[model samples]
Target: MQLQKLLSLIRQAVDRYNMIAEGDKIAVGVSGGKDSLTLLYALKKLSQFYPKHFTVCAICVDLGYDNTDFTGIDEFCRNLDVPLTLISTQIGKIVMEERKESNPCSLCAKLRKGALVDEAVRLGCTRIAYAHHKDDFVETMLMSMIFQGKFYAFPPVTLFEDKNLRVIRPLMLVEESQVKGFVKRQEFPVLKSPCPIDGTTKRAYAKELVAQLQREHPGTKERLFHAITEGKIEDWALPGV
Candidate 1:
């Protein structure tokens, strides 16, 4: 989980998916979590010498939760020299109070991502970087199959044609454990999520299930990731291919 190894994995994903191009400005979604912070750190380092010459900034969609301090994240970004944007929204109130939906993760995510995308577009960014890693990739695929009856996971690079923006996952090759190790080792300022139901979501269940499978049979995560990348799922193909 060293910076050099992390950068190597990120570069592999970027190269394999044609994620970066010359003059690309990427807005990284930083949730103040380990994964996103690791991504911001790695991408900042990568941009220092990446041949494609892309620039990166950090964005965090604040869900209007009380007592949530972003001071640590602010300093964290300043130290990395990456511009940070904090978009405040009433998503928490809308999802948890007004709608009161039994499952709020879906609606909350849509609102948060919509805010992030709109801001990224307004900032003239060509792409948005999400910190989804190998474990997220596998869990999402499992969630889709179990809940939605589909064998689909998000692609490494997704193009939003209408908005003229793309979503890229440079940490697609990194593991969640590695990300935790990286953030802990670097002593980066990590913030706990402000959501009321932080770890009780369906995705959390899927994560535990995946962990159980891995414990029973090693390399389970690797196989699931392989299936996602090489299973010929729609839109899973490489960019422009």
Candidate 2:
């Protein structure tokens, strides 16, 4: 997507959820992938004109994978003038090597997100921003259905009462294709996933299933997104968010 359209979609989500308030400090969880880098870049630009005057810091928790270098990501953050803190961890080793869990995604995700929350709190941030987009939202809902037999998707905004940190997804309105185009058009120094099972997960299955359904039912994705936005699921509602 063009820069203007990208920012407009991000702003739409931000405004809809009351995500940013004046004097809020938000730490964006940047995994260095296309989605995360796009989020970091958008927030960096949005900071200049966003009325609330929020500050952002980028944090990425490395999953202890070999041959994973964040040099380009560091430079990219530097160019955007967003401070980045790369925390190295043994999450990959613990889950894949030590635990040898068949379902590593659940454990690894919790660990990485916990680490990000800790770092955000350490940096005195009141909020955390995730790079989940429209596709991710629908894919996650489908995953829940196929795996857990539930109808649910993550909301645009969430709160962590224990950490006193609010989680916001400003890119909720942007599609995955748009995100990819934005990164390509802007030449973002994106980082690919270093995880061994990156594309061979239940989530990947959900992605493929959604694509297939979209081919059969042309407006499948849009209808799913509408259901999410229309509060078909109890948790998808904007109420008390």
Candidate 3:
């Protein structure tokens, strides 16, 4: 997707959810992956002309993995004039070595998010922008239904009451496919996850499921996403009722 189209969707989602407030300092979680890197670039560009005038800080929770290199990400952020903060943690050892859980995506995600939020708050970020796109939203909902037996997806805006920080998903309207195209056009320094079960998790399953559904039904993906944005589930209605 072109940068103009990407920013248009991002601005739509941000406005739709009232995500960015005046003077909000948002920490863009940089995983050195395509999704997060796309978010970082989008937010940085948006900050240049966005009316709300929020600042951007790029942060990454390094799980102490040897295969990943963040030097390119640092340069990317530097070129955009955004400060990057990296939080190093032993989450890989804890999850894979000590806990030794076969299905470690859940615990690994929790640890990584916790570490990111800790640093974001300490850096005085009032809010954090996640890289969850439309495909991720649908996949997460599918995961919730199949595994937890409930209908739940991430809210566009979530409040971390304890830390006084708000979570926003500006790229919520952008699709995963769109992000991949953006990454390629921009040559984002995408890194492959070194996790043993990276592609074997419930998310990967749901991704395939969504793709199959789209193939079979022709419009299943759009319909499912409509269900989300139209508030088919409780607590998903847009702000201001």
The digit string of per-residue lDDT tens for model 2 on 32-105 reads: 89999999899989999998888989999999999998999999989999999999999999999999998999
* Each candidate's clash count: 0, 0, 0
True-structure lDDT of candidate 1:
0.92
Q: How far in Å is the alpha carbon of 8 misplaced in model 3?
A: 0.3
- Per-residue error for 206 in candidate 1, Å, reads 0.4
* Best-performing candidate as measured by TM-score: 1
**Tens-digit lDDT track of model 1 for 9-95:** 999999989999899999999999999999999999999999888899999999999999999999999998999999999999999
* Per-candidate RMSD, Å: 1.1, 1.3, 1.6
The candidate that achieves the highest lDDT relative to the unseen native structure:
1
Check candidate 2 and list the clashing pairs. none
Q: Report residue 63 deviation for candidate 1 (angstroms).
A: 0.2
List, residue by residue over 14-106, the lDDT tens digit for candidate 3.
Answer: 988899989999999888889999999989999999988889999898898786788898999999899999888899999999999877888
Model 3 C-alpha lDDT versus the unseen true structure: 0.89
Off by over 4 Å in 3: 232-234, 237-241
Model 2 residue 222 CA deviation in Å: 0.6
TM-score of 2: 0.97
- On lDDT, the stronger of 2 and 3 is 2
